[model samples]
Target: MHHVTQIKEFKVIDTCRDAVVINTNIDDYKAHAHFADIRGALECISLINRGLLPKSRYYKTACKRLLTPEQYEGLVERTKEKYININKGVRR
Candidate 1:
């Protein structure tokens, strides 16, 4: 698989087109602990900061960051059983 270099990353992802257009007041993945948890290194941030992790890692990071250690092992399992509902899809 190919990955982008940081110096050239900006060129690949343009903000004018990728910005979130959802309601600011609503709590989506950004507000949920899941986001921070999934984004391994970004676990320290509590509030929102733009362009934290690469777009590719968003949903995996969300699943990791928000869930507890115990939950991580079970989340996907629960999802398979239709017990967990995650909005892993990107917001339009």
Candidate 2:
């Protein structure tokens, strides 16, 4: 039998310069690093975009509940751009 992947929808519950909270059908998840700056957050986002799940157990679980790889890549791209704009005020 062929297995199919389900693409789940994600909602940005809250976000700031240093952190973001996301919600999906499975559960709510937060992405943040204590004592880290915006750069750290950007790095984290990059890793996620590259298919590297966060080290935190909660994040690992949440990653499994997210969208398919293709859909997720699109979401990550948009999110990264948003963060960059908010932090650097870069207009494009």
Candidate 3:
């Protein structure tokens, strides 16, 4: 049998109007769970920075959490400083 090389392209038809409204209520329990997730992830990163991999598992239970850009940036800085201090002591 011979192989076919050319492939056919299909056009996507747009037939839906942009006038849809979705009303939903966000429960407090979900919000609190998300907050706990962010806090736990931050704590895990902190633990990893301190070179304690085994203890980091304690903070890996929550999910679907959101963190602000500023908070993430701050966490990065804090983790960096932690490594810096660790290396500083080793080089002395």
Compute each candidate's TM-score over C-alphas. 0.23, 0.29, 0.22
lDDT of 1 by residue, 19-87 (tens): 222222334444232222223323212112232222345644543443444544553221134565477
Candidate 1 worst ten-residue window by lDDT: 5-14
* Model 2 per-residue lDDT tens digits across residues 29-50: 4421221243443444455657
Candidate topping lDDT = 2
* Model 1: CA > 4 A from native: 1-56, 77-92
Which candidate has the top score in TM-score? 2
Clashes of each: 7, 0, 0
In candidate 2, position 70 carries an lDDT of: 54
Off by over 4 Å in 2: 1-11, 15-45, 69-92
* Local accuracy by lDDT, each model: 0.32, 0.40, 0.27
lDDT of 3 by residue, 6-80 (tens): 111111111232111111122333321221333343444344344333223223322112122333233322233
User: What is the Cα root-mean-square deviation between model 3 and the actual structure?
Assistant: 17.8
Give me the overall lDDT of model 1: 0.32
Residue 25 of model 1, lDDT score:
34
